[model samples]
Target: MLLQSPWPSRVNDSSTKATHVFITDFLKEKGVSTLDVLVNNAAIGSECFKETFDVNVVGTVAVTWANVNRVLR
Candidate 1:
C-alpha cells in the first residue's frame, strides 16, 4: 500500500518529537504496518544555517529514527 502522509514543511516543526509521534500515529491509524521505503526529502536552502540544519539534518534523522521500526528490513 502506498501511504502518502503529510509531513511538516516548516523547519522548526519538522524536527519536533511531537511531529514524529504524529506521523507514526498517522501510519498506525491508516493500518500501515510496515513501510517498504521512506523518502525523507525535506530540505531548505536558506541563508540561516540553523534553519537549514534543522530541516535537512535534524529533521531527516528525527523522521527516520521515528519510523525505523516500521521500515521493512
Candidate 2:
C-alpha cells in the first residue's frame, strides 16, 4: 500500500512509529534478533510552523523514544 503523492516522500512521527514497529514485528515474526539501523527521517518547513513542530518535533520525539524503549537492547 504505497502512497502516490505529489507531496514527496516525507517521513513523519506516525510513520516513524509505524516503521519502527513494522521492522520490530518483522524481526519477531521471523525469529530474528538484531537491529542495526533505525532511521528517524521526518521533516517539515518554516512556512508551516505549527505543523512543523507537530510533525517534526513532537512526532519525532514520540516515535524515537517509543522505538528505543520498545526495540533497544
Candidate 3:
C-alpha cells in the first residue's frame, strides 16, 4: 500500500501558494524528487457552490501549476 500522510490546508485562502511550496519542500526532504501521481481530492462541499468552485477548480489549478516541474512526465 502507498500510504501518504495528509497535509491539510485551506486551498481557498491566501496561503495556498505558500502551502504548495511547503509541500514541495517537504517532499524534497523525504528524498522524493518526482511525483508519479497527484490526487487533488479535497473539495469544499455543495453547501457553498462558490467555495466549491474556488477550492475544487481554482485551488486544483494553483497547486498543480506550483508542482508542475516536480511531476514525472
Query: Candidate 1: global Cα-lDDT?
Result: 0.64
Whole-model lDDT per candidate: 0.64, 0.64, 0.66
In model 1, the Cα lDDT at residue 32 comes to 79
At residue 31, give the lDDT of candidate 1: 84
**How far is 55's C-alpha from truth in model 1 (Å)?**
0.6
TM-score of each: 0.33, 0.30, 0.33
Please, what are the lDDT tens digits per residue for candidate 2 over residues 1-66?
233455534434468787667666756866779977654434544466677658877999899988
The true-structure Cα RMSD of candidate 3 reads 12.6
Summarize candidate 1's per-residue lDDT along 1-73 as a digit string, tens digits: 2245353333335568876766677578778776676544455334565677688889999999999989856
How big is the RMSD of model 1? 13.1
Enumerate residue pairs that collide in model 2: none
Q: lDDT of candidate 2 vs native? A: 0.64
List the lowest-lDDT window of 10 residues for candidate 3.
1-10
1-73, model 3: which lDDT tens digit per residue?
Answer: 1125453443443587876776677577778877787545465344566777688889999999999989856
